[model samples]
Target: MSINHDPKALQNPMHVRVAAAFRIVELSDFEARVLSKGYVSREDYDEAYLLYAEKMTAAGFRVEHLLNSQGYYVPNFSSAARDALVAKGDPAEEVAKFESEQWTTIQNCELGTFRLVNAIFHEQSQPSGQFDS
Candidate 1:
């Protein structure tokens, strides 16, 4: 399925809100918001995570959630780290190894929206005269 990628085209307000939040916040902060008290239900968290995974994947990123010892779900946004896991050959074995290392929980989220947000943030962070015309 083709993802719209356009924020304005999103029908769910929560999806739009989550996408907007990701634009200005770091991955940990974003996860914090979702895990905040009374922010959303368990089902809602799953939905929001699905959207996050979709957007990250669209931006050429892999989504891996790590359940830290502090009981917080942290997202691994490092491409090099993900690449290292991929280099392990078998998908099942790689996941097993990764989970055994530090994370108590490891989930692969590869559903489809946030390429536009990533692009906007990337462009804004570029120095003057550094952007390709």
Candidate 2:
């Protein structure tokens, strides 16, 4: 069977959004399938998610500073936006929270997670005394 027959081709809305945002009309079958599922796979999700991050970053919007309380699902920050918020006498606590959250997200993106290696420990120690054998 050809990849064209895959059930998860990018839906209309997703295809439009992705195409507009990424500036590309063509996508590999795997990519279309991945985006259509709304981020089910880690690698695929990261690719799209990072694109969002890159666009926002380029626009001078801090992708991590958006707050849920402020009615933003995705984190976003900009110098202009911050200034406007601060002019309204924004609460210090909320600003701090946003910054903290943004920092955490940045760190996670910068340093990806890894699985720990499994190993066995032996309770063997070399003799401290002179090895006269």
Candidate 3:
């Protein structure tokens, strides 16, 4: 059975650029579309996990990352980051510290960072990165 379309290309490594050098979680379809198209609005970030998953899957994306219902990345840390990474303590406080520290590279303030963190967590969990938590 030969298909005329290249499905994998739709979610190629180029998309990793968004996940690299930052911690991010996959976004809602609304978020993914707006973000992929380079538009950041005051959108409510509304949408459920299933919807986000299905949208990305339909787009031919693997959708490795997942955000909690509250829109928080699970938490990704390395041995190097262990000392700096917030301990498994208060989620709010740790998130605040991370936001204050890496806002620029992470893109926006807390919101952008949280998204990044979640996405990165999902990606890094796949293979490399020898750092330990």
Candidate 4:
């Protein structure tokens, strides 16, 4: 499938792309699918998610933050449409459903989800003892 690049995808930094898909989906598959639709491969999505922890620090956003927030279902930060569901009453079940569907949708588009994802999770850092520097 030839990926059709969307203008908004440019607004999405490369690192966020990688972070959004990390563990949730294989990065290779994500890249391949997006490219087939004319989307660009953005490594910055990873940097935005992992390297720029400082910018999102004050907001309580971080890679490890959502790992424990029951998978960040409260806000549905994965996509704009999900935010609507997040705002609805009793959206817990809907949020989970959206996540499953997002994994499939994002395979085709670079969503602006990193900022929202980071917003919910607390910033994580290397373990106190793991710093080799």
TM-score of each: 0.31, 0.30, 0.21, 0.25
Best by lDDT: 1
- Where model 4 places Cα greater than 4 Å from the true spot, the runs are 1-78, 110-133
* lDDT values, one for every candidate: 0.45, 0.41, 0.39, 0.38
In the range 1-133, model 3's lDDT, one tens digit per residue, is: 3221221222334334544443334443334443453323323232323344444344333445544675543332122232345566547777677645543422332333235333433444443443222
lDDT rank, highest first? 1, 2, 3, 4
Quality of model 3 by C-alpha lDDT: 0.39
lDDT of 2 by residue, 1-133 (tens): 3434222244434334434443444544544454454333445444545555665576455656332453222434555555666788889987777667655655444321110000000001222222122
User: How displaced is residue 6 in candidate 3, in Å?
Assistant: 19
| Model 1, TM vs. native | 0.31
User: Candidate 1's error at 114, in angstroms?
Assistant: 10
Cα RMSD, each candidate: 13.1, 18.4, 16.0, 13.4
Model 1 RMSD, rounded to 1 decimal: 13.1
What lDDT is reached at residue 108 by model 1?
24
